[model samples]
Target: MLVNRDNPARSNMLAHMGSLQQAAYTRPIEYQEGRSHGLRGIEVKNGPLRFMSMADRALDIAQIEYRGENLTFLSKPGLNGRNQFDTNGAEAQRSIMGGLFFTCGFENICAPYVTPEGSKYPAGSYPMHGRIRTTPAEHVGSDAYWNEDGQYVLEVSGEMREAELFGENMVLRRRISSVYGTSTITVEDEVTNESFREEPLMWMYHCNFGWPLLDEGAEVVIPSRKATPRDETTAADATPWNEIGAPVDNKPESVYLHDLAADANGRSFAAVVNRRLGLGVVIEFDAADFPYFMEWKSMGSGDYVVGLEPSNSSVHGRGWHERRGDLHTIAPQATERKVVTFAVIEGDAAIDALVARRDALLAA
Candidate 1:
């Protein structure tokens, strides 16, 4: 039976079946200590999805798998296991490239910027992405329970702070949850400024796709009125940005900025569909929180992956946003909240329904 978010009865029914399936297949949610490359972390599994977050590293989602199919790309020399705080700028950036999802930006930098507006530190001192991905999350906890509607919910929550003796004082509280019997994950983040002054807040969700799910013939669908290529390298490949190519050796990566069209609720959706495999993943986010959408297409043989990034700022560095007065800032003691949801759509009917939703939003 198909579960519809708008139909509570159907959803409950699906949840019931999911609970039964859980008894036969697995638990609703399982958390256990996991070690990768001698680094310790926590692995969480809900239904058919599994993800890992290292304690030694920042709060990045290191790996994700659905039904034994690896949905995330893991580059060579995977999971360095090095504590992010101990690593320098270059090392931090290199370690991030392998994870399934890594956050970027907070106060000092995002995308490697050298700017005077940055912390009093000199240019090129801030990391490529901000320290959030490397700044470990404390107060980590997990729970699973049956809701009033009889739906089982699995959740994990944690807090990560970025601060120094005389630097930006910001804290982020994050929670990731999934419902039993569903292939959906929701990530909610609340960032607060604890300092006495306003602070620049830049953030991007780097959701990467790879391997069989990102193989040849897969297409990225976004309902956008216009898209801007980041540079000539991207512009040259913009003609067919919706399509994916076979793994080719030495193919340059392409980046594009999309001006998305949203629904009445100010929410936008994007998806990567592999029709041949009858599988796809959909990302839904609030445009009010993430005003920009960026796509990263790396078709290189070993580095073949695509990123569906939603951000408050363009993929451009902090300096660029500051110059254009586009940087997001939170007043002292103020907080900002954002939410993003990921769901797996399988089979022709489900995929078609997703496409229909996209078309409807575009038509509106």
Candidate 2:
């Protein structure tokens, strides 16, 4: 007769954990019930980056700040309320799965682009476009890895990336295996999948910041010569005009200006003021990577959080050069990379630095 250990419950729990590890790594695995919905496992290390895996579905990241400082997520499965809704309405609602970093305008940029009579844009708007879903599903694969170097990496290929929390650090690497080039993202420290058969087009990087980390007082500074008009037909004509474009420049953080009349060097800059939270956020982009900067202030009244999106193409699937004829194009086998960084700064440091940078760029 085998004797039971001093703590029978402890022994059983250990045995259960061992079994789970074995099953999880058994080459091919399937999760049932609750495990399928919540995070299957989490890897904690470094200062505060938490890596999460949901069954076999997708991957997400949580920052250790803001209570856990939940900052970022790469959601492909469209968790809870995080799925993209129809662009037909004003201020399209973001997926509730969490905070996402990238959104593609399959039909239109803000509102579904249509003829003055209300007809939708042609089908080519989302060429080869398919549904982006969580990992562990068919044809969808996700990987979140970290080494001793303290550098963490997360890749979301087949589909898309989302924001689960307000202020976190999440990094994403995009691969276009068929094209031979890949785009990688390195974000603030806390934050899924899809298919292929068609090449990708009309994708935008939506970076969201809110209260505390990105309060109402946030300011945006660009290094471009000017700002151009944003393509949302309805919102385009609003008082103070919230949208603008830019001409490409090679300098870092060069996409800080705004354009209203679609001029080649027309870019502008602005600051975000949140009266409720008494905070601010500063945004800067690379003109070469993103030729336009669209400024949006939801004023904390609507579901909208302030966003400084860097996009490859313009609304309605128009490339930058379409208007200026100088937009960039990426070949199937070519890869392009863009970087945007946000740090917590107090008082006038953020605004001061932004102003100096903009002035220097304009002078040069």
Candidate 3:
């Protein structure tokens, strides 16, 4: 139970409160004005962890917070409706609603590049980070229920289709859920290939942290065997990449690939924590499934954010993967599943626990 939020006895908690919203719940909401006007979503509150699950934007998350401290970065695009932008080419970035959990792919990832000609898909120019983020969802719904373990669960789910007349036919079924009295969130997704032919599939969980929670001297801890800078600029001063300083006037975006350590279950974790703020975020995933972990640090003015990206492929674009002959593709009618868990670490004790766990993983 959540102390002031809930009682020790589930019977007493239910006896006092008529609705679940008093402690943990998901409420439907619609944007009234601005760029987000007409957009529909649901507010999820599971103890100290809360966020808006955008129903129209492929069920991506925005406005993530724990204990009222903002954790995710919201770009100038704001929480605009999915209809506000094009899903292909470089145009996707113009109206990109870059909230916390931005999903990239089904087609391409990283930079925009020309894809090689497939049997059906001709040689074409793919957009930066692909077209999935702006794609609206269908069959969106939210609800709360009690599990067998006696924990209350709140969830928002929907499906998004990335398709064209003669293009790759992929559908993403996503379920984002959390339990009562917990500061953790889980995102489970199933990407199905509906096309008759095997289709290209590159996916990423662009989980971003920024601002007050990511101030000067914040640290990103990862149990990795090696870390490689994305470019020459990043390699120049890569020694201090783990400790992020204050934002600069014109600092360029630098990314690092960390070959993470995994347990027997193939699970790996990476965290960004600030002791001064008593706040932190841990992004955990299966290393065997999503083999590439990109530590993205963009300290540019007004664009400061750190992304703990867990992806199935590298930061290299689709063209690079094609050239390397390791472009991953899924068989027709097959499904690719991914489950990511995010936990908010609070207080010195919690931070210390995280460090100990990370260290154990490193030693293992």
Per-prediction CA RMSD (Å)? 5.0, 13.6, 3.3
Q: Write the per-residue lDDT of candidate 1 for residues 207-243, one digit (tens) a residue.
A: 8988888998988989877879999898887448888
Off by over 4 Å in 1: 1-35, 83-87, 108-110, 117-124
For lDDT, candidate 1 versus 3, the one ahead is 3
Candidate 1 lDDT score relative to the true structure: 0.75
lDDT accuracy of residue 82 in candidate 2: 20
Which scores higher on lDDT, 2 or 3? 3
Kindly give the stretch of ten consecutive residues in candidate 1 with the minimal lDDT sum: 23-32
TM-score of candidate 2 versus the correct structure, residues matched by position? 0.48
Q: Compose the digit string of candidate 3's lDDT tens values, residues 112-155.
A: 87755562346666788887876788988899877666677899
Model 1, residue 60: distance off in Å is 2.8
What TM-score fits each model?
Answer: 0.86, 0.48, 0.93
Off by over 4 Å in 2: 1-100, 105-109, 113-200, 214-216, 223-225, 228-285, 316-335, 339-342, 346-351
Candidate number with greatest lDDT:
3
- Report lDDT (CA) for all predictions: 0.75, 0.34, 0.83
* Reference-based lDDT, residue 96, model 1: 66
lDDT of 2 by residue, 1-364 (tens): 2333454443454577654232121122233343134333233222222223232223322221222344333233333322234222332333323342333332224333322333222233222111221222223444433323322334333223322232111123333111001112233211111211122334455555443444333334444445544434423444333322221233112122254122245333333433233333443344554554554434323233445666655542443233465333333333345445333223455446656756765675
